[model samples]
Target: MAKTLKSAAVFLLFFILILLTNYETNNMVVEAALCKKRSATYPWASCVPLVNDNSCETHCKNKEAAVSGFCDTIELRQGFIDITTCYCQFNC
Candidate 1:
């Protein structure tokens, strides 16, 4: 019966270790998802002809504590004019 008890203890320890590791990973994912979102208008003086993802990312990188960005178009002046802007995904 001692052998069975030892095996059971080992299994329990292994299970606890796996649970602890999963908990830590979940906490990291939750922390990453806690970032605040923000956006800014690109080419502030005028509108661009096309959406440039690289430039939009660079523009967001210029902001303080910006993580990453993408390009999107937004309407202005009662939805008449569509302007491209850089949307920053996260600020941590």
Candidate 2:
């Protein structure tokens, strides 16, 4: 009876571990997809174009002029702000 209980406990522990691992992997995949979608929708300039540029501070200050020169002409305003914010945070 003791041996049987030990075996059952081990099995239960293994099963729970597998379940947790699977849940974690699925969550990672979902998060990656959401990140990709967000990046594609927003692009950097809309949120923080100067991220890669040498003059980030100036670009951020002149957002209206900068956006007008770049994104406004392109007309990709859907998730532009969100994308920019995410990009800036990620870079920072």
Candidate 3:
């Protein structure tokens, strides 16, 4: 009976260790994704209501963008309102 109790206690301690290790690993992976870094050709964008691609690129440049950007738009109300954005690509 004493040997059986010792074996059970060992099994419980090993199970707890496995659970704690798995939890720590998952936490690290999530934190890393949120603070992602890019060494080359990283992109940062600014959004605005725009009329033309050249205009958008020029706008991004004024905001310290490394390269002139292109226009990307999102439709809000089918054909009534749209949001135009510029994405500038550059090195990190």
Candidate 4:
């Protein structure tokens, strides 16, 4: 009976060690990726025909210290003359 108890104790310890290792590894991976990529958008009120996409990207990089940026234009009015509004996406 004593030998059986010793074997059970060893098995229990090994199982607990495995559980703790798995839990820590999963927790660390989650923490690492929690903020891996984040993004934000802002209105570009000064957007005009002369403004280029590269300029918008550069502006976002400067303003938000972003890794990259893109300009998305949407036309509120659809007619012979369209009114376009520019929105900038910043990715970090």
- Which candidate number would show the highest TM-score if scored against the true structure? 2
| CA displacement after TM-score superposition, residue 16 of candidate 4 (Å) | 0.5
lDDT of 1 by residue, 16-86 (tens): 99999999999988877765533444563222324433465666676534677666777888768977655
Backbone clashes per model, in order? 0, 1, 0, 0
Q: Give the per-residue lDDT digits (tens) of candidate 4, residues 1-92.
A: 99999999999999999999999999978866754534565555434436444465666677767665655555566655544433344332
CA RMSD per model (angstroms): 6.7, 9.2, 7.4, 5.7
Judge candidate 2 at residue 44 and give its lDDT: 49
lDDT of 2 by residue, 7-84 (tens): 999999999999999999999898877654432123444444455552333343354232222232333576563332
Score candidate 4 by lDDT: 0.62
State candidate 1's TM-score: 0.43
The residue-level lDDT of candidate 2 at 12 comes to 100
Reference-based lDDT, each prediction: 0.66, 0.49, 0.59, 0.62
Give the lowest summed-lDDT range of ten residues in model 3. 37-46
Candidate 3, lDDT over the whole model: 0.59
Candidate with maximal lDDT:
1
In the predicted model 2, the residue pairs found to clash are 47-84
Which is better, 2 or 3, measured by lDDT? 3
